[model samples]
Target: MRIALSSYRSKPHSGGQGIYVRHLSRELAALGHDVTVFSGPPYPELDDARLVAGRATDRATGPASRQTSSAKRAGATASIEPMSIEPTSIERASVEPPNPGRLRLEKLASLDLYNDDDPFRHPDPRELRDRIDVVEYAGMLSGSFPEPRTFGMRLAREMRSRSREFDVLHDNQTLAPGLLDIARGGLPVVTTIHHPISADRRLEIEAATNPWRKYTKWRWYSFVPMQARVARASSRIITVSETSRDDIVREFGVDPERISIIPVGVDVETFTPDAGVAKNAPGIAVETSAPGVDVETFWPDGSARHRVPGRLTTITSANVPLKGLSVLIDALAFLPQDAWRELVVVGTPNRAVETQLEALGLSPRVRFVSGISDDDLAGLLASAAVHVVPSLYEGFSLPAVEAMACGTPVVATRVGALPQLVHGTDGETSAVTGSAGRVPAAHGGSAGPRAHATGEADTSADADGSDAGILVEPGDAHALAGGIVSLLESEETRTRFGRVGRRRAVTTYSWRAVAEATAAVYTEEIARC
Candidate 1:
């Protein structure tokens, strides 16, 4: 079927939206469906090669007439192409290029907008530049975030003009007013809300220390109400996890029946274990605000593993309190200086985080690196003693799962979907309780003894039962530290968790399976329409 996937802004490296759009669109296309993605800056870096391959296969096997019929059935007509060019007229157009002077002028006009340090921010064709500008302009005008609403307007306008171009429209969390307009115009629309934005807004507001910051955060998330309304009105709603579905239903006031739980998939190919890479010693990797790592600092001998004694790796793109970077830092401080050597951070640190590190005397021990390629990240995960995700909240922790896919043991907070994703839970029970209770008491490992000692045997069973990884209470630095320390101290336990985690990640969260499941959702929604 012809599917139009939409995202207001798809920055693949930065957020889940971009990753979702890029992977899902590719997988859908791979399934013999026609998929076209509509996105705003920074646009997604799609696997155009895959789409090209699919088109080539189609051309090789199908006759022109049959191809046309198939295209019509899939809604892949002139209306859907960026600029429909007739096959017969293509040679004439190639021979007689557009006026060179006019072309140069157009290029010059867009040079500033297109040329930037970020490769992803490059301009698309001139025809779509104006539409992209609308989203950018709205963001500037609001002084906060207005892309969703503005992009919606632009999307609605385009879709209305080409209403028959797509059989179904799949929106990636951009529930703008224009979506409502398009839906009302009789388009079969399905929306995927990774989770409620209200959760982010609440976490930010609660984390705010000053009134101005809290107010600003409130104003920034003003678009959430519109999102909630749009989601409720949408024909179908898709979310990544049961926890997310519950949060959406409760926070957005949407009917539970309207929501479908489909967990996000990890690219196992890019995140697989590198048996050749040796694990690093006593140190930690912290990703601060800055991108890219200083090789000399983290890898003195140009080795995949760090030279430090006991190394820990943690990645946090944003230094927001919700990420619990500060909590992790505090946990690090609680450990003896000699216990863990260095902290390798993948992103840059904010002023507040820097101050906290300094106060804890961890400033010297932390190494910040950013902009590492996926392969490098996988290698880092494989080489680390343990991967820690200290987020206070998450819809789904992709980093944790990615680490698991790399055969790395993870120590994550039991918040949102972390418990279910890291420490596998009984699906039937989780659906009822909305919590992956404690790991079963029968399971062996450092977790069982710790749980019993803390008088948390009943609650702890939910966590200790799983051989995948360790889960600690959210915001509990001591508990997080304990889990990390426990894993670091025992190679046998860490190896076991890593092996189990990899198996779970591959079997349960493969992109192929996720794509098939998501396609089923689309088929069901379209049939209903």
Candidate 2:
């Protein structure tokens, strides 16, 4: 199959879009298909993603030069070779995108207004040569996110000359108005919305205290209406979790039949357990540098990777409010000093979070690591006493899946996909079936009933609680703190959850499986068209 994949901004190191694009394209190519990715700034990094478009591009320098924010690209240092295709190398109509079993990347030039180099930059009069550029500039001036809508317009224009060039078009959450135009051009279309943007707008607006901030959030998410319209009209829709699926049905009013659930996967090879580094005890290190153990085992030939005792960690692609970084900090404050020692966040620094840490006197105990490799992250998870997903919502968390693959037990909120991914069951029943309280550490412990918000009950738990990891109510710092404290206080329970989680991640969320399912969707949509 010849698949044309599209995305707006893809930060290779941190964000979900880049990770999804890279891994999925690689896996699809491995399955004997030709995949050409049409992406905006900060293009994805792929082994064979060197696809050249027959047409000219706006930015010839590619990912590095197009980057807008230094913070967004804090750890995004890997560089791709300059695009070697010259102007008029090939006409738009005459194209050959590698063989059936390869992947290529094509860069789509964008106005790039929100670049950190000069945020909300004023476009030179000469730079606004096209209508798309003008629209992008005007949207930025209005404090509204215009990338999705503008990127779609650009993509629609690019596809005008060759609509039948590919078997199907797979859009990566860029639900701009132009997608309807693409589908009308006789191309099979599939849009994968991780979650409803409406939820983001609501959460950000609610999180804001200032009325001006609330108004700005409302203005920023104004594009969501167009997204909902496009989502409703698309031939097929894909989402990561049932939570997101439900939200899309309710929030966007898209028919449930139009949506298909295809969860994301982790690289099992990169995220495996390290037996050399001993797992830290609840609040202390177990001694990795003692006796015959080599120090190199603890520290690979990489950058600084200090293994903190009693390490509690979480990952966020961006330090946004919906991710619940503040909630995590609040939960940490609820614990005693000895209950949990240090926190390690895997993302660029945020000033708001830093200020919160300073106010709570957790400045010294918390550390943020960025730009690390998958191997480094796997090792870190293996060394952690507990991994946490304290987000207010999630649409299938890759970080949680990766941690589980690394055999690290997780403590996550009972919202979105966290419950299903941590619960060792499918999307529906896993979260509700588990007991709320701690799993007994004693061998052959009796089970309890299903738990409620303000009350407790008994259910049949996996004596080992291996059926799932610990889950707490969303936005409740007290419940989150109790869940973490319970895991830290018992090594037996943590070990069981970690073992079960690892098994679930390895067996359930295979990249091959995900690619196969996605390809099946492509085949069905193509046939329908």
Candidate 3:
């Protein structure tokens, strides 16, 4: 089947959405389907060999000036070489060559409104040169994210003229009016809502102290209403977890029957444990607000516990209130100075977080690191005594799962799919079932009841009495601190949990299985069409 997959923004390092597009497209192509990913900058980083081959072909066949223009636009130098190909059989002379089974990535150029140095800030002239669409640029200038709506417009316009080119159109959460336009034109459409954008808007509103900031957040999330409309109208909806599915239903008013749940998968190969790699000092690794790991402010006061050298790492992409970084920092205050040696955060912190760290006098104990490669991350995870995810809510916590895949124990909040993923159970009867006091349920209501009837709860704990990870109440710094302290204090428990987590990651979360299940959904949707 020929499939057109769309994502407004799909930079691999940008977030989970990019990772989803890259892995899923590769797996679908492996399944003998023609997969074309329509994305925006920064484009998905595909295999260098495939990209080089494609670019070489394009350059060799096009005019020299055209080649130069393409190379300049792509921000890369292009070199071309011709290779001879021999026909396998004389019979092939009379028939057309079959299409190669490889994933194709096409990035739709747009004004990259966000700066690399400061993503939320407006871009300078150098950044503006790459942007092509005028309407998209205007949206960005107007202080609203225009990618989803604008990408949908471009995709719809492109597909309307060539609608017959694809067997199915899969949208990666860009629920824009253009999607509804395509669906109305008799094309099969599937939109994956990782979670409702409404949840994000609400979180941002709650996080805002100033009335103007809250209003600004509201304006930024104004695209959500259009998303809800498109979601309800799509032929089918896919979500990462039951927690997110329920939130979608509540926030978007979509029928429960239309949404299907498919948990995200981790690349076990890339994230596997490396015992051969030396572990960092006995400290924890903290995911910072930045994309890479920054380790500047880790040394605490003159003491032996601080000198013993262990790190506590927290990985967070955004330093927002919903991430609970402040709560984690607050939790550190409750712990004894000797409880943990140093805190290593993967991303940079926001101003609010910085203030909290300063107020608590814990700035000396925290080190922030960013821009580290995935292999380096795996090594970091393996080195850490424990991995911590302090998010108040998540559609699905990829970091927690990735940490587990690296044979590292995780301590995360019981929100979204964290419990189900960490416990290695289905959504219905996971370890943390009840909604009360668990980070104010995603949509302000109980997640209804377990869809599937089960007699007993599946224990995440192994026979050795170690759980894959512990689930704590969201926003409860005390509980979070205690969980981390407990895990840090016991090597036996930590080792057992790590073993169980690694096994769960390997067996239950393979991309091949996820792709097959996703294909089944596609088949069903196509049949309905």
Best by lDDT: 2
Give the Å error, residue 230, model 1.
0.8
Descending-lDDT candidate ranking: 2, 3, 1
> For candidate 3, lDDT tens digit of each residue in 1-529?
8888889876555457767876677667666777877876655543322322243422221112211010111111244322222332100101111335455666566665664656755445555542336667777667778889888887787788877888889999899998888887877898898898888789889988899999889888888998988888777888877788888989999998887777777768656766214334433344443333454422222111221235676777666677778878887887778868777677777777777777787777776666555545565566677788888789987788788888888877778888766655532222222211011223221212311122112223444443577767777777778778877777777778888788878876766667777777888888898
| C-alpha local distance difference test of each model | 0.64, 0.69, 0.65
lDDT of 2 at 517: 80
Give each model's clash number: 43, 7, 36
Global Cα RMSD, each model: 10.5, 8.6, 9.9
Per-candidate TM-score against the hidden true structure: 0.76, 0.82, 0.78
Better of 1 and 2 by TM-score: 2
In candidate 1 the C-alpha lDDT for residue 381 amounts to 69
Model 2 lDDT per residue over 256-344, tens place: 88777888877675566662243332221222211343222223423223334577878877788888888888889988899886777
**Model 3 TM-score?**
0.78
